[model samples]
Target: MTTLAEGKAPVHLWVVGVLSLLWNGFGCYDYLMTELRNEAYMAQVPPQALAIFDAFPVWAIALWAIGVWLSMLGVILLLLRNRQATTAFLIAVVAVLASFFYQATTDLPQAMGGASYWIMPAVIIAVTIGQWMYANRMAAAGVLR
Candidate 1:
C-alpha cells in the first residue's frame, strides 16, 4: 500500500540524521581531544568567544559531550532500522537550532564575515530539518511500520 515517495522518506531522513550526528559528534571530539584543544587554537579565537565558553562550568561541558555522543548513538540506532532514533534526533535538532539562533543573532552580525565559514552550519541545519520532516512524514504514512 505504500507509495514510492513514502518509502524513500525514512531512508533519506536516516542518512541525513546520521550525517548530523557525525558533524556535531566530531566537533565535540575535536574540542575535547585534538590540536584544537591546544593554546594555539584558543589564542586565535576572539576573547569574547573564549569568555563565552569559559562562562559555562566544566560540568556543563561534560554534559554537552555526553549529549553529543548520545545523539551519535541515536543516529546509529536509527540507521540500524530503529525508528526511535527520531526522538533522539529531535533532541539533537533542538540543541543545534538553539546554537544556530544564538550564533546568528550574536556572533554573525558582529563578525567581518571572513571566509564565510558559517555556511557549513547553515547547510547542516537545512539538511537536519529536511531529514526530520521527511522522517516524520514517512512515519506518519506507516513507512516505518
Candidate 2:
C-alpha cells in the first residue's frame, strides 16, 4: 500500500515518466540528425522532405529546437519529481504549436503535403499536450515536488 503522505511516488509516475522519456528521446534524436544533416540518416529521408526542411526559416528552426529540447528536458524533470516539469512542458507545447503554425502557412512540396506528413505532427502535438497535462496533474497531486 502507498499513500501521498508517505512521499513515495506511485508506480504510474515511473511508468509515465519512462515512457515520456523514450518518446521525447526520439524527438531529440530526430532533431539532432536533421540539424546535423547526418549522411546515413538523411539518406533514408525522402528528397522532397529534405528540401522542405532545408527551406525552414531560422525562426522556425529555432522553435523546432526549443520544442524538441525542452520537451526532453521536461521529461527528465518529470522523472526527477520536479514541479518545474509542468512549466517546461508548457513552453514546449507553445514552441511546437508555433513551429507547426509556420509550417502550415508555408507552401510545402506536393509530396510532403500528404496525410502521412500531417499525422506525425498531429501525434507530436497531442503527446506534447498530454505530457504537459500529466505533469500538471502530478504536481497538483503532490506526486511531483
Candidate 3:
C-alpha cells in the first residue's frame, strides 16, 4: 500500500524507464551506424550471443535496429494508455518478460553489456504495477466511477 503522495511507482520503475530510453537510443545508434552487424566487432561477442541474431539471418539485424524505435513508439502509446491501460500494460508486461528472457539468454552470461535493457524494463514494470494498483484502489473508492 503506497501513500497517495508517495507515488504508486517505486524507484525501480523510473530507473527501468530511464534505462529503456538509453538502451533504445544505443540500439538506434548501432543500427544507424551499421555497427551492430560489423563482423569484426560481432566476433568479439560471446559465440552464444552472436548466434541468437545469426539464427534470424537478415531479420535479426533489422529487428535489433528497430527495437529502439519500437520502444519509443511504445512509450508514446503508453501515455495514451490511460484511456487504454490494458493495452499499455500488456505491451509493458511483454517488454518486462522479454527483458528477463534476454537476460537469461544473453545478458547475464558475461558482463551484462547493456545497461539500457536492465533499466528500461524495470521502470516499465514498476510503473505499470503502481498505476494499475492505484487505478484499482481509486475505482474501489468510487473515484474512477
Candidate 4:
C-alpha cells in the first residue's frame, strides 16, 4: 500500500503534490522548449533575451538542467510519498541558487530587461523553498516513507 495509506493523508498532501507536478511540469516544458530552440517559442522571445539563453555557458546550462529536472523529480517523489523528496528538493534549491548566482553576476540580468526581469525567478525561488519545507514537514510527520 502507498505510504499515504498508513494514515489518512492530509488534504494538503494531494493538493500540493498535484500542484507541484503541474508547476514543475511547466518548468520542464520551458526548459525543453528553450533547449530545443523551438522556432515558434524562440520567436516569441525578444532577440536580446534569447541571446542570454543562447549564450549560456556549459556549466550554467548544466546547472539549469539540474534545477529544473531535480525539481520535477521532487514533485514525483512527493506524490509517491517518498522521503527522498526532501533531499531532491534541497538539491534542486541549491542548483537554482547556483544558476541564479551566475545570472545575477552576468550581463543577462540587464539584457533580459533589468529589475523587472527578476520577478519570475523570485517566484520560482519562493515556491521551491516552500516545497522543500513542505517535504521536510511531511517526512517528519511520517506521511512520507
Candidate 5:
C-alpha cells in the first residue's frame, strides 16, 4: 500500500473531496426539499411521483434518509482524512441499495418509467459504490488515518 507523507494529503484527495461534497450536498438538499414539501420544489415534481414517494413504507423512507445523511457524512469524513469514512460509505451503499430495491418494487407512473428513471438510480449506485471503494483504497494506502 502506498503511504502518503505524514499529514499531507495528495491533490487528488482535495479534488475528490470537493466533488463528493457537492454531489452529496445536492442529495441532502433534494431529500430536505422533498421531505419538507417545499412548495416551489414540489411544484416541479410530478404529482404521480409525489404520490409514489408519499406511499413509501416507513422502512424504505428510513433507508433513504440513512443513505442520504450517511453519504454526506462519509464525504465530510473523507475530507477530514478519517479512516472511518470507509465504514460510513459502506453503510451508505447498503442503505442506498435497500432504498433502490424498495423503489424498484413499487409501481411507478409512466412518466417515471423512462430510461432516465432507471439510469439515475444506476448512476447513484455507481457513485455510492465508487465512494466506498475510493475511501477503502485511501484507508488501505494510509492516506486516511
Candidate 6:
C-alpha cells in the first residue's frame, strides 16, 4: 500500500545510513589512534605499515584526518535524514580520493609489506562513493529532508 508520492522513507535508507555510520565510526577511531600514536594499536601494526605511517608528512596527515572526519560527519548527517549529507559525502569522497592517491602514488605503497595494504583504502573509497550516491538518491526521492 506504500506509494512513492507519500514520501515515506524506504527501509534501505535506514540500513545504509546505519551501516555507513558504523563504518565511518571505526574509521574515525582508527585515525584517532594512529594520530595519537597509541602504543598498543601501533604495536599491533606491521612494521612496514608502521614505517609508512611514520613517514607521512604533516600535510599528508592533515589530508588523512580531513578525509576521516568528513566521512564521519557525512554518516551522521545521513542518519539524521538531512539533505546536507549528500554534500558532506561528496566532499568526503573527494578528500578520500586525494588521500588514497597520495598513498598510492607516493612511496607508501611499496613501503607496505604487500598488496593487502591497498585493499582497505580501496574499500573505504568505494563505500564513501556508495554512501554519497545513496544519499543523493534519497534526497531526490524526498526521503531525506
Better of 3 and 6 by TM-score: 6
Error of 4 at 132 (Å): 0.6
lDDT of 2 by residue, 39-111 (tens): 9999999998888898898999999999999999999999889989999999999999999999988898888
Query: How many clashes does each candidate structure show, in the order listed?
Result: 0, 0, 5, 0, 0, 0
Reference-based lDDT, each prediction: 0.58, 0.93, 0.47, 0.90, 0.92, 0.82
Q: What TM-score against the true fold does each predicted structure earn?
A: 0.56, 0.95, 0.36, 0.93, 0.95, 0.88
The C-alpha stretches of model 3 lying farther than 4 A from their native spots are 1-20, 27-36, 39-44, 56-69, 78-89, 95-145
Q: Model 1, 54-124: lDDT tens per residue? A: 65555545545544555675566555545665676676567667665654554432453445757866776
Runs of candidate 1 exceeding 4 Å displacement? 1-25, 31-49, 55-67, 107-117, 137-145
Candidate 1 backbone collisions, by pair: none
Which parts of model 5 have CA positions greater than 4 angstroms off? 1-5
Q: How accurate is candidate 5 locally (lDDT)?
A: 0.92
lDDT of 4 by residue, 1-145 (tens): 5554487879999999999999999999999999999999888998888778878899999999999999999989988888899999999999998999888888664557577888999999999999999999999989988
Task: Report RMSD for candidate 3.
Answer: 8.5
Question: What are the C-alpha RMSDs, in order, of all predicted structures?
Answer: 5.3, 2.0, 8.5, 2.3, 1.9, 2.7
Model 4 has how many clashing residue pairs? 0
* Residue range 26-142, candidate 3, lDDT tens digits: 655655544447766565666755555455434434444344455555444333323233344345445445544554464343444567546855664565455445434443443
Ranking by lDDT: 2, 5, 4, 6, 1, 3
Residue pairs that clash (backbone atoms under 3 angstroms), model 2 = none
